[model samples]
Target: MKKLGITLLVATLFVSCSLSKVEKSARKTVDGNWQLNSVTYDEKGVFNTHLLNDVTATCFENSQWFFRSNNSTGTYNILDSDCSTGVRNFRWAANEIGKDSGVFDFTLKFTDDKKKDIEKNTGYRMNLKYLDDNHMQITQTIQFEGKPFNINMNFTRTTL
Candidate 1:
């Protein structure tokens, strides 16, 4: 009876530790779904931006990101930051109406939103900050019609 009880306790502890590690790894932005929390957009160490309050959530499955944001929802083929893949591809409906789909490729890029907005903009850059499993900050440099613009978008997980 004593030996059986001890064995059960040991197995329980092992499982608990393993779960904790997995949870930590999942919280990382590169691995799983992360929601934007807050951002402060700046250029040359100064702030000059215009953006509405927005939130975004991204999920990685089968090497693609099922991305959803304010006024946009689509599937994005994402490339990792390691550059193992050349670029990410995505197809989204045009204008959120008429149910038309278009394709775009984001090359030399990184982020959970890469493939979503790849075309037209030549130099789009972003960085993601993970606050927890449910919170993140996404900073974006949006070039409008080949002009420079800055934006900071925040999002929180719906589950959270």
Candidate 2:
């Protein structure tokens, strides 16, 4: 009984330590500028596409999402080919929705120049996954034409 109790305690400690390490790594890995590289969608089937394949993606071309670690504030710079360039300031955070779960609840809130909420009660929330130090993926599900559509966006770290 003593050996079993000791083993359980060691296992619990190991798991707790591991989770904290992952949380810290996630916070660091997402702090930087990320440029959209590719996009994929699944409605009826998987469709591999690029940023220029669709109107929405095209507008996102040359766009950069900046995530700051200091104040958890960032900016989304949109450089549309046929539209004027604009910047949207926002607050971002890496959060977990459930206890001891590895799932990441990435959230963003767009704010105006005065730091007032522009989105009011709505904000962007998505599942964030880090592929590596310089690559990350964001997944979002939306209802389009009364059907559910899953969109996956892949981004690579940019130096600018």
Candidate 3:
């Protein structure tokens, strides 16, 4: 009876662990180029608006590098998505194009790009809202210079 109980316990632990991890999967299968749909403040005393649309950005782990741009040369990366955190881990070559004045002065993009390994491991809770089949609103809330800001990006996929 003791041996049987131990075997059953081991089997149960394995199944439970696997089951829990499955639910931890990121909310979306984020493995492609997505546009900067819309970024909103969603907070009081905050001013925000749509800056760009259908920005070209590619997310491919197997590619030499992922690329993101606004119809011109913009940002790219060979990114790994934690379908668990929706955080895209970039390998190399990421850029923020265009000039815009927001509540945060577009600083989040730069800060996220230069994060260290220890910091990158702790993923942020990404809030991305899907509109229709190919449209999405990506909102990244982060702290820059010891102040919190939310950048709302709106985008639609580009058609070839």
Instruction: Judging by TM-score against the true structure, name the best candidate.
Output: 2
Candidate 2 root-mean-square deviation in Å: 8.1
Off-target runs (Cα >4 Å) in candidate 1 are: 1-39, 42-123, 141-150
lDDT of 1: 0.38
Candidate 3 residue lDDT tens string, 1-160:
9999999999999875541221122112223455443345656664523222112222222222122321112233333353121333332221222222111112122224443343444333444443344564555666655887666556554442
The candidate that achieves the highest lDDT relative to the unseen native structure = 2
Give the alpha-carbon lDDT of every model: 0.38, 0.73, 0.37
Candidate 2: which stretches are off by over 4 Å?
1-21, 44-55, 145-147
In model 2, the Cα lDDT at residue 88 comes to: 77
lDDT of 3: 0.37
Error of model 2, residue 133, in angstroms: 0.6
Candidate 3 wrongly placed segments (more than 4 Å) = 1-7, 18-29, 43-122, 142-149, 155-160
lDDT of model 1, residue 100: 24
All candidates in order of TM-score, best leading = 2, 3, 1
Tell me which residue pairs clash in candidate 1.
36-155, 37-136, 37-155
